[model samples]
Target: MAACAPDPEPRERGSRSPSASGRTARPGEGLLAQWDADLLEAAGAGDAASVTALLDRGARIEARNEDGRGPLMLAALADRVEAATVLVERGADPDATDDLGDTPWVTCGVTGSVAMMRVIWEAGPDLTVPNRRGGSPLHPASERGHADYVREVLATTGIESVIDRVNYNGWTALLEAVALGDGGEPHQEITAMLLDVGADASLRDRNGRTALDHARARGYGVIEDLLA
Candidate 1:
């Protein structure tokens, strides 16, 4: 559930608009801009050395791209574990959200990278933060049938409260799992994990359909039994 915002208009390298002082550039502004750009590039490329170099050169670790995604977010989105580690170790905020309110931790759920998840988690992200859809990372992980990611999220402290949190569409993690799942082993395992952690089977969606109804309608007998 990444945020969807129009990208900011592109700017030239080291370019700056005229300020109130009629100055097109300030002291060290060009250097900082270039460092930020390099940091983004290094992060996206998973070049830990370049990332560290940029950080050491006073690049703002939280500097965002046009989409409001910072270095850690880009690294997580790209599954660049090494770059993510470098950013986190250099004091990047793992909980930094993009324009869509999607944090690096939440992005890890989408990538289904346990290593990224662990790296971001160890950096102390706020697991309670919801994405733009008003769902926690567990929501996307569950919807995508990412059993391992779902388990890791549930294992996080205070994440149990997020399991039953409904999204903008009124589908909780369990409901999404049941609705979007293929009734495969992964889905079944996810369902079991949610249930074992006390996810309410009786929760309904915006259409007033419960997880059991979805399972039954989809003819997911195994899931139906679990919901029952």
Candidate 2:
């Protein structure tokens, strides 16, 4: 299994650097750091009571740990729908991105969590938020064959129109789907849906081959015919 990458930056919301402690150490400094630690743990564990208690005690709701992961991000990663919902309702920014520029919506899309994604979307995440690679959450879902999640995102009136959106490599969601799909009935179905919805089947990637060319190279006869 691939190791889970750590968050690049850990924001110390209430922790004082050791340098500052040399001149004068405050009695409550230790207590404050401990409280922050508790808040992070509670958010990860999905303990609603603990979350509320910590926040009420002045914990930074958006505090990021060493990985730049906020409490809401942790909850979403854990698939705690209720906890995620609660955090968003408590004013967590749904559009908060990690150091890698992956937002809550992008995480949900990558994890294939339709329910969690809906929660984030309803909380007002911009579906068009692109990552460092210029790919939005929709690209991952469509590429990974998360059909239900893809449908959910695509059904959003304006979002569906991005089916032909190309990334830095000039590969659209349709290109990704064709490249990664198994070429079965489902793959052909998705490909057809993409094309019918205005995906530019003829659009080539950096390699100068259209999505159908890739399908043909991979022996996806049905998908190739459908695109053709």
Candidate 3:
């Protein structure tokens, strides 16, 4: 006859069961989660070597943070040119948007990094996608008086027709330049670039004010002349 096994000891009262404590995760989940954290940190710090190593170690290239900011977007936001290049080359989507619906293109414009812009451009971001602020890459660039960004957008092959596209405020790139500019040389350069690319001076904002109107109202003599 086989001997009976001893009875298992009872758990103490109020002791948590394994299932009650937490859900069981697959083995890969733990590794992937750690990798996600490492990848985001590396990307935010612009550490291209660390980013590369993490990706090679099975980190998800498209991992995002709480704000919906993917690694590529982080690299762009941090002005990590090499890190951005690595992510883009690894097939990161250039058009991936963050919580504010800001794509890498808009981020590049905000950061005023032409080098990042070039890398993202090679990945084929949509030139016409608007951010949560109801503006495109050109809108923020012009609004912030980033002449180089404006020039880059104009120089890109397919964006010629979108130069005068309006944002949620019905303000065109030219309108933003005139409305948000400080009337400095940078704004002047941006306005000139828009005009040189054939931005319509006659366009109006949601307030029914044209770039010329805004320029005149702001006492921007040079901009008024350019629009005129």
Candidate 4:
């Protein structure tokens, strides 16, 4: 499963605090401020050329906006795969978490950007790192039923241990999948896949609710049968 966090849209360039052009500027208001502003603009627009230009001019590759989103995260959220790639190549922190504790990979998964997800995942993020709620990327993937992403993570990375990891609520991937109610065939299949992959079906959450109990209470007979 793809565990991603909710990504908010970035602010437009023009809306940013501007610096006065040419001299006449105060210590805090000079070329540096404008450069910072431009870096954010390049990130928001996914203009790789512009970003490269700024970076060549000594722009910090890891510049954060007022909202605390790094260039890489902004690019990923915009589905700008190329720009994201460029940023990553330029030393952008793939594991940089926003104020909300979401990394670029998590944002990609939550936004259902399969292509972006692939890019970030390939860049080598520690997928086991939990979000603010203590659920890893696998938790969101299973919850949202992103089967392909889920399968890719499992196949391409060492995600088996992550699958059975419990969250703040002590819910594992299987438990979240069961509680997510039938997101469709993908969800059902993912739930089944988790079990088949040796997810601990007998494990219970903080409330003492096991995946088996969740499936049974929700009338998910297929999942219940799988657990049994």
Candidate 5:
């Protein structure tokens, strides 16, 4: 999800430098404060040049909004590949989770951008990290019918463990896909990918229902056939 905090208001032209309230400006604090919002703003807007320029002007690359979302996470949520590339190259940590327990890598699954995945993958994300919901990246990708991400994260990364990881809700990637998907072509593809990648379909939900059981109940014929 994109950072929920609204963009910070612009400082008035010719205003005094921004500073942390109730404290004297440190050597570089004022500069960082002035551009803190600018860095995140550039990232979310996919302005690689602006992001680079802001950083070059002493803007902290890790500056965050009220939600504690750094530049890389904002770029990830926006699917701003160019901006993310600049952030990553400038040492933004893809593995770093925000206040919501969402890392740039985790955001990739929700955004469904294979390009973003590639960018984050190069940073070597700790795939074992779970989001606030105790779900892996595969969970959202599966539920959202991100077939391309399902194929990439599983097929290329060779990480079968993600497929079977159960969320706090007792919904594994497989279960989430079956339970939350729309029973459409994209979802069918995701189901097939999960199965092919060794997702443990035998696992049951909190209600003790298997994926096939859910599929059957949902009248998802193709998924039922796949599961059967």
Candidate 6:
């Protein structure tokens, strides 16, 4: 089996102004970065036309905000599929990561937007890339109860190596679905999908507890039955 990948922090992206570049403000480069900042705003706001115009005017497609979030990452975070499409068409990197190690593709998993997932997937994101917390895209999707995102990506990407993969904390996507999730409909759906796709039921977390154990501990009777 392929080695598992990791995850990033699950915190929301910081509220940044148009610019989020962590780079030192070079005195002479301030003005030049403004257009890039504009592009960031446009992408985040789903202004596809503005995004195109900025890029045409030589806005850095890779320009980042104060949070290290580039235009494409912002677009993904906001589920601005149109902006993301324009950015992708203009050579923006979907794999661009932010302060939290979240790329546009990884952020798609966070947003649970299957549409955004398709956009980033076509751009060929590195499925193996983990977030800051050492969790793969699947980890966030599973934990956050992105049932459709998990199901579609699993079907479309057809990459099963990530199914039973563990994170830095030794939690697999299955473990996360049970441990972090609230066992709501979405969470239950995600759990069922993971199991159906052959996620390793025998996998244990760093605490050496199975997913079934976690479900039972949390009174997730529905999940426990699934695990059983």
lDDT of each: 0.86, 0.76, 0.83, 0.76, 0.87, 0.85
Q: What TM-score would each prediction reach against the true structure?
A: 0.86, 0.79, 0.86, 0.80, 0.86, 0.84
lDDT of 1 at 188: 95
Please write out the lDDT profile of model 4 over residues 12-77, one tens digit for every residue: 443323446644322233555667678878877889898888787666777788878888888887
* Cα lDDT of model 5 by residue, 1-228, tens digit: 896998988964444455668553443556558688888899999999999998886788888888989999999999999999988888889878899888898888898999999987888788898887999888898889999888888866656766688889999998889999999998999999889878888999989999999999999999999999
Show the lowest summed lDDT stretch of 10 residues, model 4. Answer: 22-31
Residue 136 CA displacement from its true place in model 2, Å:
1.1
Between 4 and 6, whose TM-score is larger?
6
Angstrom error of the Cα, residue 221, model 5: value is 1.3
Clashes found in each candidate (C-alpha, N, C closer than 3 A)? 1, 2, 0, 6, 0, 16
For the record, the alpha-carbon RMSD of candidate 1 to the native fold, in angstroms, is 11.9
Cα lDDT for residue 181, candidate 3: 87
Q: Let me know the TM-score candidate 4 reaches against the reference structure.
A: 0.80
Error of 2 at 164 (Å): 2.5
Error of 6 at 189 (Å): 1.4
- Using lDDT, give the best candidate's number: 5
* lDDT tens digits, residue span 144-175, model 1: 88898877767764688767888888899899
Candidate 3 per-residue lDDT, tens place, 51-136, comes to 99998877898888999999999989988989989998899999898987888777877878888999888888876787767777
lDDT for model 2 comes to 0.76
lDDT of 6 at 81: 94
lDDT of 3: 0.83
Alpha-carbon error at 220 in model 5, in Å?
Answer: 1.0
Structure candidate 3, residue pairs in collision: none
Q: What is the lDDT of residue 210 in candidate 2?
A: 89
Clashes of 1: 1
**Candidate 3 TM-score, true structure as reference:** 0.86
**Candidate 2 lDDT by residue in tens digits, 176-221:** 8888677777567667777767777788888898888999899998
